[model samples]
Target: MTFRSFIARTRVLLGATALVLAGLPTAASADVVFQSVANPTDVTKFTSPWCSSCSNQYRIFDQFTLGSASSVTGFSVALYSLAPYWGSGLNFSIWTANGNVPGTELFSQSLGNADFTTTTLTGTALMATTDKVSGLNLDAGTYYVSFYNTNLAVWGYTGGGGNLLQQGNTYHTGTSADFILTNNVPEPASIALVGLALVGLGVARRRKA
Candidate 1:
């Protein structure tokens, strides 16, 4: 081949290699969905984008009946920050609420906080405190979980108030983050329920005989 043609072919091969390498890192960072293995009532997980001004993620747990009369013995909540930027360098704070909004009561019991500076998308931070609702004694009803950008100074970089990061929106400023929620499984109760059903079936067959 001529000198020019050889140089052109070499450039095309180099460009293809560069594109493949560029895509590998993003493939590694894609978010993972956490699946529940036990009772759906016993465990729940939710995820949403971490916006500066808006509540990106919200969950209403009608299954959980909490009050002075009923108590959740094995209740647990785990929060995971999935922002690629936070894992890289950007800093932000996340907050949670058991109710909806200014009128709703926020979770002040301090489950815990996670910094994703070094962890990958698979990395997670946990707050495994037991009887999380005992102290708060939240009323029996639905609850809401929200995340906000606590650093006003940093959020200001997005041109100040109301420019919150949205889910699936490409970030033009700094990095955006996501959140994850996880609950513990009620192993004993689930196993017992299954066992009782089987026993009941056996007894009914013997009586019929």
Candidate 2:
């Protein structure tokens, strides 16, 4: 191939490489923490802040049900707090629901003072954290998630006020904390394989030309 043609093909290969790299999954993410054996029934992802009428030691309560068997590795949440609330530590936990409210405690975990980090969200300031990993496995039923032990964060909503259903599915409970759970370690997305195919196609087209 002439030098100009060779350069053009090289650029195509590099561009395709960039796209694939961008789409590849991270080594780990609290976002895609685990794979589910069965879909979570009445699934909803929750996040809360003390938007109004919240007090010290406020408790968050949310519930979800699994269709089959699953093991939850950890949880993560969007935490909102002001300067006054920053402190030495924060606590979180999972529990069973009684009449769709916080009930018997099942598992609990704690965070160091510095673990919480902040970012701007929707023109609001908030602190969010990575998956606080745990060793809780749940069955084909319902359970509640709660975030407590902080004087600094907002309550987002009270008693199921701001929980959102996963786009098309109904939420399992009326109210809960903002958190995501993982059943196993995170996995790569199928898009990476698609990227490889695209790269192959681009190389083939260049050769034919």
Candidate 3:
């Protein structure tokens, strides 16, 4: 092919790849994306290893906004246990953010009562998908997901000894870092749009050729 023809073909291929990727579901697209999340260092960086004697609640902060109003169905918790959830019997309280800093609690639920299970190969942490938590409508604004009520360890980053959460009449710090979690579903409509985008890409390529 001539140099000009080769350049055109390369552009088409790159455009096609970009279109395909744009359709894929990503954390920012359809998942519970965290804000100011701590980086994972090691398995031993588990925060809140034990809340048995603790009478306070600790919650991390996340600021998420949507292009349009949508309902958040559920989330997944990052834990650091060597055994199954039932083996250690872990539970947590789910909350929806309201104000700023430590935000006001809008919704509440027992994480144990909801569906929970390990998602990865090691089976260290648990993930409860949709149908676990009820629906909560979200719009173009900031929000936070907070949890407490168990002694389970969480894969967190850089909040262990610094006050990251507050409960009762006191502000508490992390044992190591902040808890890592996200509870949201990629809406079926969004998934369908992605598929359509990919298909359209094929048509566009054929037309370009």
TM-score of each: 0.26, 0.52, 0.45
- Compute the lDDT for candidate 3: 0.47
| Candidate 2, 1-209: lDDT as tens digits | 88578768778876876676777775554434322212221222323444221444245455566666676665545555455454545666667767635568888878776665544343333445545456766666766665656454533323443342221223434444444565445446455556667767767786788
Number of clashes recorded per candidate: 0, 13, 11
What candidate 1 gets wrong by more than 4 Å, as runs, is 1-48, 52-69, 72-102, 111-134, 147-209
For model 3, state the Cα shift of residue 66 in Å.
5.1
Error of 2 at 106 (Å): 0.4
| Candidate 3: Cα lDDT at 3 | 52
| Model 1 lDDT tens row, 1-209 | 66567557656765655565455432112221221122221112223323332242322111122233322222322223344322222221222332422224445333322322122223433322232222332344433322323311111122211222332343333321222222333444454555556655755565566
* Per-residue C-alpha lDDT of model 3 across residues 1-209, encoded as one tens digit per residue: 66577668767866766686577655433354432344443444554433322433444333334455556555555555554223333343333445535456666656553366555424454433324556555565555555454454445434432233434423334333243334455654466667657766865776688
The best candidate by lDDT is: 2
Candidate scoring better on TM-score of 2 and 3: 2
lDDT of 1: 0.31
Which whole-number lDDT from 0 to 100 does residue 75 have in model 2?
52
